[model samples]
Target: MKLIIGGAFQGKKEYAKQQFSLQEDQMRDGKEADFEELFRVPCLYHFHEWIQKGLKLGWDFDGITERLLQENPELILISNELGYGVVPMEAFDRTYRETTGRICTKIAAESQMVIRVVCGMGMVIKNA
Candidate 1:
């Protein structure tokens, strides 16, 4: 698996596409993808939004990263960095932010490659 992350509008998606030679249809938008689609899709963007939805729906995220790694070892995930700025006032907001960070951290540790995009440029932070 691989991870591409950056702040919103940082062109992570474009970079991932160009870097991997992926087409639009080959990537799935996490916001609307079915739960089962995650394991089947080659790439998934807007992953943070999908996590938020799962949290709101009381879905257990435990072992999900592991499942993805096992089921789709070649998957490329794109998520917006959400750990910056002031803390949120709402409890749910805080949970969502922290959950996304923790999950991304886990994914990064196991990913064969991890890239951070900024201003449409990709900086490879990790490469196996």
Candidate 2:
């Protein structure tokens, strides 16, 4: 199984579904279904918690990596890429941007392929 991890609104997830012929409203099928179910259940709290944990204690990042290999599932996890750019001036903005970078790092590390979608265009980052 293979997966993509990038950023929010990067078309990562969309491309995955399209590649699999998955309907917009339809759930995933095949061996990957269980992994996909992670997004189906309501996020316990602020969805951002997942990202923060990744940067702070590597909880989110490590967890995702374990799941990917354990399930050997095809995946596409989107994130907001915020590094290699400006430093956020506000606290909340800084948190969001920082966490985005951490999560992206984790996801890309496990990705067999990676792409950076900017201005609606996806630039392949690895093994395109």
Candidate 3:
């Protein structure tokens, strides 16, 4: 599995398409997908939104993580880096940011490759 992260609109999707030779149809928009449907796609974009949905639905992080890992599919995940700027004032926003960071860390640890996209360029952060 591969993980790609960056700020919003930083071309993470484009980078994944180029790097993985994936078509737009092959990439699932996490915002529109449920947990069960996520594994069906080769790439998952807007992962932050998926996390938000899971949180709203009261899903446990460990459950989601385990389910994802158990699938063991070659997937490219795209998430916006929400922890780089000023801390959020709202309680929910703060939780979302922290949760996203933790989840990304867990996924990255299991991923074979991790890349950060900035201004349409992909910088490899990890390869195993």
Regarding lDDT, does 2 or 3 come out ahead? 3
lDDT per residue for candidate 2 within 54-90, as digits (tens), equals: 4454334447666655654454454445565678788
List residue ranges in candidate 1 displaced over 4 A: none
RMSD values for the candidates in order, in angstroms, are: 0.7, 6.7, 1.2
Scored against the true structure, residue 55 in model 3 reaches a CA lDDT of 88
User: TM per model?
Assistant: 0.98, 0.53, 0.94
Query: Among these predicted structures, which one has the highest TM-score?
Result: 1
Model 1 poorest 10 in a row by lDDT: 30-39
Give the per-residue lDDT digits (tens) of candidate 1, residues 8-103.
999999999999999999999989986788899999999999899889888788998899989999999999999999999999999999999999
Encode model 3's per-residue lDDT on 15-65: one tens digit a residue. 888888999889889898887776667899999999999889987677555
Candidate 2 accuracy as TM-score:
0.53
| Model 1 residue 41 lDDT score | 94
- lDDT for 98 in candidate 1 is 99
Error of 2 at 3 (Å): 6.0
- What C-alpha lDDT, on a 0 to 100 scale, does residue 90 get in candidate 3? 92
Q: Looking at candidate 1, what is the lDDT of residue 22?
A: 98
